[model samples]
Target chain A: MPDLPIILAGVINGLLAGGIYVLVAVGLTLIYGVLHIINFAHGSLLMLAMYAVFFLFKPPVGIDPYLALPIVTGGAFIFGYLVYRWLIGRFNHGRDENILLITLGLSIVIDNAALMFFTGDIQTIDVPYAGRMVELGAAFLPVPKIISFFAALLLCGALGLYMARSDTGKAIRALAKERQGARLVGIDVDKLFAVSYGIGIACLGAAACLLMPTFYVSPTSGHAFVLIAFTTVVLGGMGSFAGAAVGGFIIGITESLGGLLLGEQLGQIGISLIFILILLLRPSGLFGGKG
Target chain B: MSRGTLALCAAGLLAAILYPLVVRGLAGAGVGVSANYLINVGMLVFFVAFIGQSWNIAGGFAGQTSFGHVVFFGTGAYCSTILHVTHGWNPWLAWPVATAAGALVGWAIGALAFRAGLKGSYFALITLAFAEVFRILANSVEFTRGGLGMLIKADQRPENFQFRDPMWIYYLALALCVVSLAIAWQLTRGRFGARLVAIRENEDAARALGIDVYTEKVKVLALSGAMCAAGGTFYAQKYLYIDPSIAFGVDKSVEMLLVSMVGGAGTVFGPLVGSLVLTAINEGTRSLASVVPALKNVQPLSLIVYGAMLILIVARLPDGLMGLFGRRKSGKRHDA
Candidate 1:
């Protein structure tokens, strides 16, 4: 076995990675909850956020990554709102596969567009905080990742509170629990759905900010991450906010600890194994009950 | 099937078979574009059609929309190639091995997912997860040569599934496509096919009616897995290349799904129509690239066009191109 310090460090990093998954998965679950459409392009939205962050951090703008979070989140919300209004709204009444196909197509478009425009080269913001590290007694954690983990936790908590407490949040929850019931309650479900999608994407934007400091952005990078996010969301049970938060951290720790136990390659396989088993043993996920 | 529809299918089959001869002649006459069209477009049309058709067995007929058929496709490709390249096994003999391997993997996936009671998008996502895992494994493992991939040299003869003529590959794919279409046709017309379709329409109702939904799903999933692996085998042989990306790429999965969906899911003829349209668009854009020369720099133009077409097909042509060929009532009756 490895040293205790190294294991703790792995767990910390895993938690950070899992934090990102939680945020992204929450968006995915949110969309599925209210809109009842699995947004396949949720990762693409995250990719877009990463790119937006990168552009904003470039020489012309030179904004700090943390400072750019609100801008990216707000922009992503509007972007998602328009996506629903223009593209997804057209197929709302069709079979679930139609939305699935459209989102898959949209992902292809955005990913390829990024490929052409960004030239498929990995992009990252050269933030000064990247080099900074904080000693946590047992092991040192990178400043950016540590910051990102806390930020992710804070955002997830805030979103959870909003969903649990706010009027629109309750409306969104109500819609997820029973669409027709929410509709009968004089809730403008369509508008709420669009806003929910926006918020979902907004979460992804926030995730991108959390990740841009520690992760490389690429056209195809989002695909793998999307799979992990799906696993996370599914693990937490789709539409379950609390489940997603807990599931994210569980998956995160699973990945990092698995990596520590096995090599990085086999560790990924371990994550997939856990995902498959979780899917099989508890399809409703860790915090979810059957619908 | 109706006499008219049967005739249309027969006529389409004849056209497909005779197509190579015409292209051969055209190429001989130095109408050189026919050469590219024959090999690239024609081969891919048949190849993708076969895949879409195989996928249709489970996805269309049984209402199991698997988003990750490429795992089995890649498995077949890798199985055959690895058997041939590493073990010095004859490629022709490797077909059964690959097919069995594909079916085994498919059965495992189906049994697990079905046993878990995964439905709709979750089922699809699980399959995709499996494929990604396979891709990653293929990328990491030394036996598969990792991401650098493995190539079969030209020195191997027909026994090894290599041929000097490019048209042989096209014909092989075409023959496979024809046989698959025949199989799909017969199956769709039979009681087993009806059971599959019944499952597609309503699983709970079918279960209540004493249809063994689980077994039927796993069986078709395995059968289609074998069929798709056959396509993968041809892909590896004809391309003389096998890689994790080429074998298990999400694009390949999307291509399979799109072709079936665009052709007409749950219909035997749908994939044929869909693949032809998709191949035509692909070749059309490709030829345009050569003509404009500048279009080559655009790189991902074909993908962009295909993606747009998928969206358009989903939005407008809900039933796919097959909808245009059949009457509304017959199509509806045939589907549900």
Candidate 2:
């Protein structure tokens, strides 16, 4: 058995990792809520954003990842909006299956394109503050993880507030809840769909900025997040923001504690098993309303 | 089936049978064609087509849309490989047991998922999760040699299922493909297939019409699993190596889905057509890459094209390339 301090450290690390997972899951759930399609390319898009941050940080155009956040986030938003407009929106015939295939196609293209241009070599950036640690009780956490955690919280808070208060946000919510009704009520449903999708991907951009300091970027980097993100979204509920937030934290702890208890290789089974159990036992999820 | 369609099928069969001989003849005559290379390519097309047909049975005909059919594939490969290598069983004897293992897995997954009333994307996601679980398990278990993988000893004899000539392997793959096509054709002609189609079009309606949707789904999955597992065993024997990644990778899942979806889901010849097109694209890109000095790592370019074609197919040609010809004979076949 591990000591109390060790357990506490695991919990702390899990919570920190949970922050990033929350950001990713929130994006996914938001897209599902609005568009009713699981964006299979979500992880690939994140990988792309990470590459963007990497380029911005390297020699000639040297910029800190934190500073590159705004640029990447805004670019991701526009890219996402156009993608929805040109590709997804054109073929989205209200069929869940078609959308899934389309996104799968998009992911295939993006992943392979990355491999072609960037190669398979892993790329990581060195930061002065990367080694800096914050000691809280028995936990020794990296400075970047701490910053990322707070930033994720602040971003989610702002997104929640925006969705609740802003006119566009309310319209997006209405559209999600009742699409035909929202359309009858004179909301530009198509444009709102694009906006919502853009916002969803913009979240990935911010997550990339946070993730790059501590993680390496590779063409196949997206494979790691795809299952993890799907698990978080499914565990949290398909289309619930609050559900996703809570789900992210639960998954993070599960991963942390699982690694602590089981060896690293076997620990991964916990996430997949949890995903299966959740789908079988409670498809609606904890905060979801009758999936 | 129409007379034209039957004649076309006959011609295609003839071409397939003659392909290896023609390649060899060309090579002997010092023609541009390479016998070994073309034979290898033919084998791959048939093998991929066979596996793709397995996906077609469930995903295309039944509209199950699995994102992790590789679970069964891996199960069969590992099952046969382990039985032969670790337990010291004959490869031929291990084949049937391995296939049965795949069918069992498929039944279990189908039973659990269908019993829970999981459908559409939920079902798809769950299958993906199941594959992940199996992958993790395969990576961790000591008996399976964890990540070190398993290797079958090379004994190029007729009884060993290993062949001295690549032509034999090609013929074996072609035989598997023909059998798979027969199975798919039977589905198109039988009441069982009709029930599956009904379920695919609308499960609630199918159930309302007194069709045993659950039973039919499970049966189709088991059948599909058996076929895919057989292909897996063949693949393992041909390569003589089995790894957790090779056996259970998501890439194989994607490949299976891609071939079926891109060629034409539901149609009997869809997988064959898809395999042909994808293999051509793959080989074409590789040759082009080798010819061009500037493009050092252009292997992914083929996949990039595949991805683009997938997107285009989904957007413009929902019925796939087979759909193009089938469009001329509308209402002749059941299409989702």
Candidate 3:
């Protein structure tokens, strides 16, 4: 028989992990769907957002980190737009290797710039409810983790609805599926690409803000979650929204369960191994359409 | 080959070989020689060059950009360290074992990733995930000594391959660099290289032409892994220490890619030149920091510089520094 408390704790952590993974993977999936590029800088952008919220919440402003989410997201959106217009747009139809290399270089620049500004010290917000826990029978769940989990679910659901019903969203999807058809239909492909990039960055920015309540903010902290996000994206099938969501939960659970069974370190290794195995077994992903 | 080119190569080799002797003579004449600093930079150059060449096997040749190469490097370092520290095996004996381990790991990853039809960004993501997994596992294992790191026995012995002189380590690293370049050059000019290029150009076409895409990719990945493992072993031996952060770090993987890209990916001499240039920049930056106190606390400025340089190179000089020299005009014919 399993220990009920341990299992419950795992479940709670899994949910939190799933939420965070979704936040990271959503941007990557969006970039892939729209531009067919991986946006290696996506993780670094998350780092930038974390710092933005961190600074905005400091001292004179005295705004709560969570409250600064809008500002962070807005900043990321603008930054993303600029990046798409100035950097990514220049390389349309370029080789995939070139895109990867360029984005990787961008990631380095963002990460190191953060490091230079913030001095590499790990800084965490001391929110009023930071360490507080809620009791669920025998299991105690952290408050911040619960908020993040629900927040992620709500945001993803909203985004899904917007994409399904909104005019701009439809145009973006149309462009993603068939560029020539979208252009024939009078959709401005360049503007659509920029908007999608902005939205992707905005998602990451919101996630960073949400993450500050639980995790410490550091220049390289994005590196910690970036790989997990990538794993989720792959597990869910590249560019599949629902897949990203489901994959996020699956990965989250795997990490939590593996941690409980093996150890925290082995948990990550186990997740990676499982991700590879899944890729081997199902190339198109569990829920993805055939390539 | 032109006389000038041959003379240049000869001159570079001679200068590298005699640099230590020149420094020693200068020191004997009471002119200060920073032999330690030079050796440190030189070792970095060798390590970066070795990693770049290894990455070029998959990324430059096969056009499969993998972001997780540090996993093999970390594996090699950890395996060699465990063998020597726990099992009392000789470092020389441990090198092949580590390389074998890397090869096996690479084969497994390639088998899974390639079979799934993951390419480009997808492949890079998978590789990055693998590295992260390795890092997490390394950090959690008590046997690895965790974040505290595993330290080798301090008393230096030639038999143990431990050295007090930086020159010994420098020469060893230079030898490794040379060997790695030789292997890369040979592979890039062979039948396998031709097959890799064909696949890179068009997988479907390559398959139509009777190429076994999966097998070839796995083979190249394994070879690359083995080479990287060998490099890692030498790195561990040279430093006399190993840590999860240093061994399995993502930065290490990025450093390799950056060096390769900067020097000119797919070219034989690209990795070596990239490593040398980057290493020089790194050393120059550190020395500059000492001269200017304000710059001392600016963490990751060097990385920022590298990143900016990479972006500039990609945007303006896609062919890199080697392209400017006109060494391999034929390489341009196979642009992705």
DockQ of each: 0.54, 0.74, 0.60
lDDT of 1 by residue, A83-179 (tens): 8988887766666766787888888788878876777888888888798988876767788888888888899899989988999989888888898
TM-score of chain B of 3: 0.94
Q: Write the per-residue lDDT of candidate 2 for residues A1-291, one digit (tens) a residue.
A: 789999999999999999999998999999999999989999999999999999999989999999998999999999999999999999887447778888989999999999999999999999899999988998999999999999998999999999999999999999999999999999999999999999999999999999999999999898889888988988888999998899899889889988988979898888899899999988988877876
- By DockQ: ranked, best first: 2, 3, 1
Estimate the TM-score of every prediction. 0.94, 0.98, 0.94
Listed per model in order, the count of residue pairs whose N, CA or C atoms clash below 3 Å is: 0, 0, 0
Winner of 1 and 2 under TM-score: 2
> Between the candidate structures 1 and 3, which one is better when assessed by DockQ?
3
Candidate 2 C-alpha lDDT tens digits along B1-336: 789988988998899889999999999999998898899999999999999999999998888989999999999999999998999988899999989998999999999999899988888889989988988899999978889888999999979999998999999999999999999888888888888888988889999999999999999899889888988899999999988888888999999999988898887888899999999999988898889978868999988998998888877776688888834322122332
lDDT of 1 by residue, B20-89 (tens): 7887788898875557556757888888999999888888777788889999999999999999889998
Instruction: Record all residue pairs in model 2 with backbone atoms less than 3 Å apart, i.e. clashing.
Output: none
Docking class of 1: medium
Cα error, residue B131 of model 3, in Å, equals 2.5
| Best TM-score among the predictions, by candidate number | 2
Q: Better model by lDDT, 1 or 3?
A: 1
Candidate 2 CAPRI classification by DockQ? medium
